[model samples]
Structure formats: structure tokens, C-alpha cells
Target: MFAKTQAAAPVEAPKATGPAIVPGVIDFNVPGCKPEYPRASLRNEETGTVVLSVLIGADGSVADVKIDKSSGFRGLDNAVRTQLMSGACKNKPGTVDGKPQQTWTKVQYVWKLD
Candidate 1:
């Protein structure tokens, strides 16, 4: 008597999570996220990095923003926050397992004089 052989099942490929939008990606060219330098800060020559915890909606809109770390200057911090919350920044939503999801991500904005 001969034994029968079974066929192997097909395996599916892992899904791609696409491009990540980490803190390093947050910059002046982030679509509508270009924050104008505060006039007071500009005149005072204040420069620092403002760290923020931003909640992005699945529809690619900034839902909320909280300052994780201030830039030492209230004007700079407020400027960055205002820009994000003003519905002007159209961010690409963060993805999980290749699917768009509402997520909170850290964003850093650096204030520097040219």
C-alpha cells in the first residue's frame, strides 16, 4: 500500500505599513503645517524646539495638540500649537498594520533665526 501526499497551503504576504510619519518628518513642508514665526519671538531672537503630542484624526486632520515640552518661550510654543489646531495642517494619518487609524504622535518644531 502507498501513502497519499497532501498539498501545502498558500501563504499570504505581510501587509506594508507604508511610510511612517515620525517626529523627524514633522517640518515646515508638512503640507499645510508651516507655522509662522511669532513676531515677538523673532524680535527677541528666541529659539528652541517645541515638543508636542498631537492627535491626528483618521481623516488626516489635527484633532488636538498638547505641548509636551515648551520652547522656553511661550510665544514659540503657542505659535506652533495654534498652527496645528487652526485646521490648517493637513497631516497624513498614522497607520497601524497597514490601516489608517486615529493616533497620537510626537511632533517637534524648531524655532531658529535665519
Candidate 2:
């Protein structure tokens, strides 16, 4: 006699609310300030962009800083961190449903010759 096989339940895919945007990149705003590092010290005279990974708290302030992409110069990297930590950059805290949340943000700093 063949044993009765149980029917499998249908699987449902997870529903997506909408377009998912990275918290950091979604609400990123650059601060206005002159380049702290002199142009003479830059390794490249041409424009350079430094992308940094920064941890922002619910307070909308930089909590941590790490160089995701270096501009090939130590000075430039340090300057970027300095500006961020200085609170010159005003960032809107990330939120899922109108509630502020801590998130890691990727910010780019463009360094150009003056």
C-alpha cells in the first residue's frame, strides 16, 4: 500500500514596502568649509574625493569615523575626520518610521586645489 503524502503549504515571498535607501546616503548633506589641508600638501594636485564611513547617533552627531576610501594622503583623511567631528556637517538622523535611529553613513569629501 502506498503511504499518503502530506501536501506542502505554499511559501510567500517577503513583501517590500518600497525602495530601500541606505540611511547614510539617503540623508547626506555636505558642510561648507574651506579645505583645512593646504593644497601644497596634497599628493594629487587634481581634485580628490575621500569617502568615509561614519557612525551617526540618534542625536545627529558623528559618533565614529573610519576611512572607507583614502585620498592617498594622511593629512587629507585626518582633515575629513576633523570636520565631521567638529559638527560642521549637519546631518539629519536616520529614521524608519519617524523615529530617530543610529546608522552608519558614507560621506564623501572633495578636496581640490585652491
Best by lDDT: 1
Cα RMSD, each candidate:
7.8, 4.3
What lDDT tens digits, residue by residue, belong to model 2 across residues 22-88? 4643233454433476565654564567888888777777778899999877777788788777776
The window of 10 residues in a row where model 1 has the poorest summed lDDT is 19-28
lDDT for residue 43 in candidate 1, whole number 0-100: 85
Model 1 residue pairs with clashes: none
Q: What overall lDDT goes with each candidate model? A: 0.82, 0.70
lDDT of each residue in 12-110, candidate 1, tens digit only: 989987766432124558767888998888888999999999888877788888999999999999998999888877877777655677788887888
Q: How many backbone clashes are present in model 2?
A: 0
lDDT of 1 at 94: 74
Question: Can you tell me which runs of candidate 2 are displaced by over 4 Å?
Answer: 1-12, 16-35, 39-47
